[model samples]
Target: MNMMVPPPSHSSLYYCFQILLALVLFSLQMLTHQLEASSSKVEVLPGFEGPLPFQLETGYVGLGETDDDMQVFYYFIKSENDPKKDPLMLWLTGGPGCSSFSGLVFQIGPVEFEIKEYNGSVPSLVLRPQSWTKLCSIIFVDLPLGTGFSYAKNLTAHRSDWKLVHHTHQFLRKWLIDHPEFLSNEFYFGADSYSGIPVPAIVQEISNGNEEGLQPSINLQGYLLGNPITTRREKNDQIPYAHGMGLISDELYKSLQKNCKEEYIDVDSRNELCLRDLEYFDECLSGINHFYILDSYCESDSPLWRRSLTHELKKSSSSHLTDTVPELSCRIYSSYLGRKWINNERVRKALHIREGTIGKWVRCYKTDFEYEISDSVEFHANLSKKGYRSLIYSGDHDILVPFMSTQAWIRALNYSIVDDWRLWFANGQVGGYTRTYSNRMTFATVKGSGHMAPEYTPEQCFSMFTKWISNLPL
Candidate 1:
């Protein structure tokens, strides 16, 4: 059958032009950068007292032919149990812009900021008893440029979700090329939150590279996502989540469902009923903390804080540092302290952070980021069909990425249940629930935890990771 094709509209032509230009610019960036994969061993940091017990290395993997073109910074922590045999993970922190430092110091990392009153000095560091470093060597990266210690000579290079995955995959190859000693170790790609969009895609990139006979073949075993953003529909799932959690009344919930059709994120301006119902929904959720329901919502955790807080505001938040976390979510306070600690000149020098690289490091920044991928279910399906082991978990208390949504996507995979849903334990108590699927994928929930499960329920998350990584049924 022959069909007449419509001429490309002006908007479509412009979009195509934009994509072509981006490709040219990106190729130029590749040629211009002076790629250097450098590493430095650190014995001590400013906050932590005395010599560090675990081995920590900080380095930069250049992404271009010239300096400042793009330098991706990273912190490598060798496995405490057995670096030689333990799984090696290239962990990306979510935010699409958040530093992997969150994964290191806040979530699964060895040392955490001692959450207490900040005496205006460098915040103290305390060792986490359930650090994931015990089971695996982790590479915590400042990915996608302009994130943490990473920087780009041109800010334009810092745009796009596609670019983020591309650069990260490149960084991994360069890193493994430099550290070939760990190439034979079981490798995993892990991340949380917004990384759901990129981590799976990164896995696909790796698989493609390996198939193409790339050097230093990564012993790719599997991957993990903690409270991941699997699909955009999850945001829409929040309305049902709210209603079920008793945040909204049945009458209002019914009204929303009837009028808005559960499309809350983008209600039509012309649809008066839908708009009114959405406003009611907003009113119900206005003061509530979306990250974790249990956490007390503070001024810093407010929407205004997200919109207005600049570099200075982020670096100097001592008001919340008074009297053992009064008026502050412990998570936000710890994050504030982390910002303070990392910005310290001495701390940067100790970690061997490149001078003149970053001006201020925000814990999470989405302003410069460009979102292209709306759903990662395709990547998940593709990876699962290849028999890649996966651990997809959610924090039960997190409304940001609810457990229901995680389960929804997992169910969409159409993999048969290998292990029916059951409780997983830690410390002789229920930690979370778990279920295994036909494709070697396991899904679990961290009870009473938030968006970043490990940040709140470290012990349970650790237990989950240890068991799953060791091939034990959890």
Candidate 2:
């Protein structure tokens, strides 16, 4: 996401974003803010072919306060464009526990894990040309602890969406204090997927602190989100999204719309028509990937037995390699490469991950975090009134948090349409459709993309991002 001082009342879905919840616990005085963060300059990575062309720093920032024993890890990449002038971004990945490293490599970072079958060595890396770092400095973070190399004294105790926002705000302020050189830079809060649950809340916290005249104030321009989950409507919109995409029949859709009132999830037990239609809907999407409907359904598991099967096949090195790993063609297999890479001791040492702090590093920590805030639309509504710019984009193919849900929330704000729905282009072809609102909020779609649209359509997203952030027409 970029911030190029967008035209007044125009927020084309390329510039910036944010999300939100309720409680604001910004007691800066209670926070024992420290300037000394344990960070390392990483010029070389184990799997990369040579020295990194861009600057990379890995470090730990105290979340709530110093001595809190909950360290949040972050990967800071200075903008390849111009750190002195480019906007700075605080990126949060979804899954609630998915490491922001996934955002760094799999989504918008300069480097990505080279996908290949395991040979017991380091998974190689390659550069991504469409990295968002090309536009601005990005701090990809592992929030709420227990993710990536971050550790917490009591992970079980910290299980709320509000806590993530609380700590994330602290993290941003503390990180800025440590690197005061970028204090004047335009800052944005950006995230995707489930993070849409907390990002707006964090943005609110920051806004609250800034208005209270907190020290080292953030220039806080705007925020951006991709395929964001704004409210519980995400569950209610899937059936319609499926129907619109031809994944379900018209008859089934009519039955659902009439009997369920378009609410497939949480249906009344006595509603037999709704129940019957839902079963058919489920059957229709049986093998479809909820994250991306077009892709073959693949379990995102790289279990020990699967690896053992790979090793057993290594005995011949020419066992056709077919069916050995059903996930080979799946995009998640690249995540498997990342899991192995981050867990390697040498890679850990190189990245300066504190030893003994965490167990095997996971791409996403599937924690049953307490869902304290079910609806964050209020946060967006609140931010919209504050006149902070925001860009909300969705991958048209994502059923998990359908674009329809995003549109519903945006409409809920009741802002006048400044720019009507129209297709935005990239490379002279349709990139996606966009609409701007009177509240400085813009919405857009990434054609044929799934969740985390940037991961699947980097160039188009970058094109969309650069244009909106630069205040250029999209």
lDDT by residue for model 2 (1-474), tens: 987985655353333332111112333433434323678899999999889999999988876444547888899999998999999999998876778998999999999988888778999999999998998899999986777777777887776788888888888898998899999999998898778889999999899999999988999999999988777557677777778888888988898899888665567899988788777776777677766777776653211111221121122112222233545787777766777788889999999887777876766665656677777899998999899999999999987778888999899899999999999998899999999999999999999898889988998999998887776768
Question: For residues 46-165, what per-residue lDDT tens digits would candidate 1 score against the true structure?
Answer: 988899999999988988767557888999999999999999999998776778988898899999988787778999998999999998999999887877788887866566789998
Stretches of candidate 2 exceeding 4 Å from the true structure = 1-36, 64-68, 300-326
Worst 10 residues of 1 by lDDT: 304-313
What's the TM-score of every candidate structure? 0.87, 0.86
Give lDDT: candidate 1, residue 63. Answer: 84
User: Measured by TM-score, how close is model 2 to the native structure?
Assistant: 0.86
